[model samples]
Target: MRPAAGKTATLFKDTPLALDGGAMLSPVTVGYETYGTLNGARSNAILICHALTGDQYVASDHPITGKPGWWERIVGPGKLIDTDRYFVICSNVLGSCLGTTGPWEENPATGKPWGTDFPVITIRDMVRVQAALLDHLNVESLMAVIGGSMGGMQVLEWIATYPDRLHAAVMLATAARHTAQNIAFHEVGRQAIMADPNWQDGRYYDTGARPEKGLAVARMTAHITYLSEDALTAKFGRNLQGREAVSFGFDADFQVESYLRHQGSTFVDRFDANSYLYVTRALDYLDIAGRHGGRLSDAFKGASHVRCCVISFTSDWLYPTIENKRIVHALNAAGVPVSFAEIEAAHGHDSFLLDVPEMDHMLKGFIAAAARTRGLTGGTGA
Candidate 1:
């Protein structure tokens, strides 16, 4: 199955893409989707970076899943992001298995998919590719760059690396860096993938078999982290699955187990296991502070000119409110104008992506204020 349908793909040749790991891809490809119309001066463009397991189909139907856009709640003509007033765009990141060139892409040298041979990439690398896409689109600057979770990490990198390219930035349900616990959780997922006998050292492709089982486990493990314990209890708890009592055997006896098994099973359909490994590795290496001599505030020194918002969810233990608040504190220390909010959510890290009215209102207000400052209805700030 193709990674994307009706999406735009750009092939950039001649110019080598220098990765954060000191490797290069001379003819990297990017897959992206855009909505609404770009204003005359391109002053009303917004970039919506997506989280892991998400694609460029931000405001469109998923070709594979047949589900409405993941953020359909926020980006329609009359929604919070208002397609009527802004030209919004989303792109699959560099190392994703989507339409973008990734581990599944053929390696000219080996005459096979890159697989484990794909060079390591970072959040900064992903943002750099996005910067290139903006150049290709002729959007000299953006009204705002917004993201959540892994996507938020990309936004943070954008502000740090290309602060002058965007007028405002929003990072929701994220932190300046991954905590030890976060890395540990990811490690478990990674190990689950590698442990699969079918992993075949990441070269499972064209082998007539794939590591779907391992990939499912990985997705299942990570999915649990995206939810709060309260949410789990409310949604499934110890309830039996379509039965009055336990099965006594290990066949998804509980509703929660059955739910997770379904989640993992469906995930393997649309996502590639190798891409999962590559993307998770990139996340594990996220160290915004480390790049700036171990000081988070220093990472945003040049972002003082950008308007910023850092949001967190009350139940999101994956990257808790305190971790997100640290980012706000760093932006403040860097003298940037910023907003901070911890929405009372019961869905944990996934709260930002869910139908949270408080988050909607907060984002609407911030974006509206930023638009006014941007003169969205009139002359370009240029």
Candidate 2:
């Protein structure tokens, strides 16, 4: 579906945005959406960083899927994030295919899609682009920044690179670095995309054919990591798909196989194959500790004043409770004020995206206290 008018705003700048790959990206374009009002003091603005596949539709109906926004449950007039009390902004990241510039965009010099020629980007690069966007919006400092998974990675980069600009941060289901197993899983997805006949070395744009099959496999593989084994088992246990008995063939006879197929097929409709490769590569390179003298505590040393809330799900093996605790430990060592929670959940890393009563309440309380401190509510707001 075509994008609805006014749902998103794109910012274009002719100045150069220095990339970590030692290249200069000029004429940068970012797609973003904002809700509620930026109060007179502009002290109530919150930034919501999206996950790997999310876009700028934080609390609105998505243009493509016609579904409610990804975080609709927690971000609305009377919800936890409370749009009535705070202005919220969300943007498509640097290498995203949504409204942001990415490998899928046309190159002015070559007059062709950038494809694989797009500069390799890091989480820091993505955060840098976002900082530029904030500058354009005249938002000097944020009241709070909230994110999950890959979104959480960007939050870490923000605290590291621009500590003074952040007031509070919320990190959920993420890690200080990608483990070897994480890299291995992403590598499998990357190889699947490259092995597709239609990939054409990432130059398939003009051919009118795409690596949908390969991209689907990649999405399917990554989706597994977002979920827990117990959740999968409980949802589709020994169940057959549209049949009374197993087909005994290679076809998708099981319900779980059919579910994965659906997830893969639908994903390619809105995501680009090359963007997948680039974003996954960026995730593999995430190392908050490595970038700061081989110690995670050093990563947050500059952000001692920033209030932080770190949360993890018990079932999230992708970036388990242990990984999240490491973040809390680092913050503690750095003398940063932080609260940690390991919510008892069975849905795994994706739990942050779902309805969890404890998470919702915890976030509400934390954000409310932060808002009060920022003079955005009660007598202070008046």
Candidate 3:
């Protein structure tokens, strides 16, 4: 479905901003939706950053897929995000295709789609554009910045780049830097996209030749990381798809194979393959600590005004609990007020996007506590 005429007003209001990566982007737009009221002071603002492949439709139904927003379970009128109590804003990141500046956007210079011309973007570049958007909205500071996965990386960047701009931060199931193994997975996805003949070197716009197979394979590979081995085993195991026994053929004889195929096919419908390449590359290039002399604590140094909460899921093997622990240790060493929790869940890395009772409770408590500390409500002095 196409977006309404005014649906993307805020996102597309501004023109493309040049990036530090030496790329000129035009007609750059961000797709976002806001919830609740900003209040008289505008101090009740909460920014929600989305993970890779996630768009700005956090609480509302998605425009493209017609499915409920990715985090609708946790971000609604009375949900954990509590739109009734705070103004919440979520936007598609710079390198995304969901109404954001990306490979799919029209290039003014050549009067064509950017495609491969869309220069490589870093996570920091994404944050820079987000800051510009917030500035355009006249939001001088934020009550809290919350995110998971790549979203979590942006949350860290916000605090590090704009230390005095946020009152609190909540990062869930994320890491400070991309590991070599993570980069390898991303490389595999990129290779899959490039290997497809239909990709046509990223210029298949008018050829009606989309790299669907390649994009699907890439999505399938990445989806596996979002799930745990145990979860996969329990869900599919050695079961066959609708057959009592294996077909003994190369087709999707296994239940797991069928499930992954479904995932890939549906993903390509809503996501652009080139955008996938750009966003995944951005994730691979993220390194918060590296910008701070390789000391994670240094990243938080002098940011005493911001309180932080780090959460990890036990089954999340992608980011893992140890990753969250390291972030907590760094925050503690920086003398920053922080809280850490390891919630027990069976959903693996994607648990943060799913419904987990303990996670909801923790978020409610953390946001409430952080708000009080920041003097958003009447409680102990912030």
Q: lDDT tens digits, residues 1-382, model 1?
A: 4365466556557688899999988677788889999999889999999898898889888888899989998887877888888999899998897788789888878888898899989888889889988988889999999999998999999999999988999999997788788888888888998999899999888787888898899899999999999999999889999888887898988999999999999999899888888888888899999988888889888889899998899999998999899889889989999999999999999999999888988898899888998887632211
TM-scores for every predicted model: 0.97, 0.96, 0.94
lDDT of each: 0.88, 0.88, 0.84
Clashing pairs in 2: none
lDDT string, candidate 2, 1-382, tens digits: 2233233434445667788889787777787889888889989889999988888888998777778999999888877888888889999888888777788887777989899999889999999988888888889999999999999999999888899998999999998799999999999999999999899899988899899999999999999999999999999988999999989898899999999999999998888899899999889999989977889999888999999999999999999999999999999999999999999999988999999999987888889888877877542121
C-alpha lDDT (0 to 100) for residue 135 of candidate 2: 82
The TM-score-based order of candidates, best leading, equals 1, 2, 3
Residue-wise lDDT of candidate 3 within 1-382, one digit each (tens)?
2233113434434465567677655555666778888878878889999999898899888877889888988877776778888889888888787777678877768878888988999887888777877886778889999999999999988878887889999999999888898999989999999999999989977787789999999999999999988889999998999988777789999999999999999998888889899999889888778877899999888777788989999999889999889888888998988889999999899999988898888888888887776567642221
Tell me each candidate's RMSD, in Å, in order. 2.3, 2.1, 2.6
Q: Which stretches of model 1 miss by more than 4 angstroms?
A: 1-5, 378-382
lDDT of 2 at 379: 27
Residue 77 accuracy (lDDT) in model 2: 87
Of 1 and 3, the candidate ahead on lDDT is 1
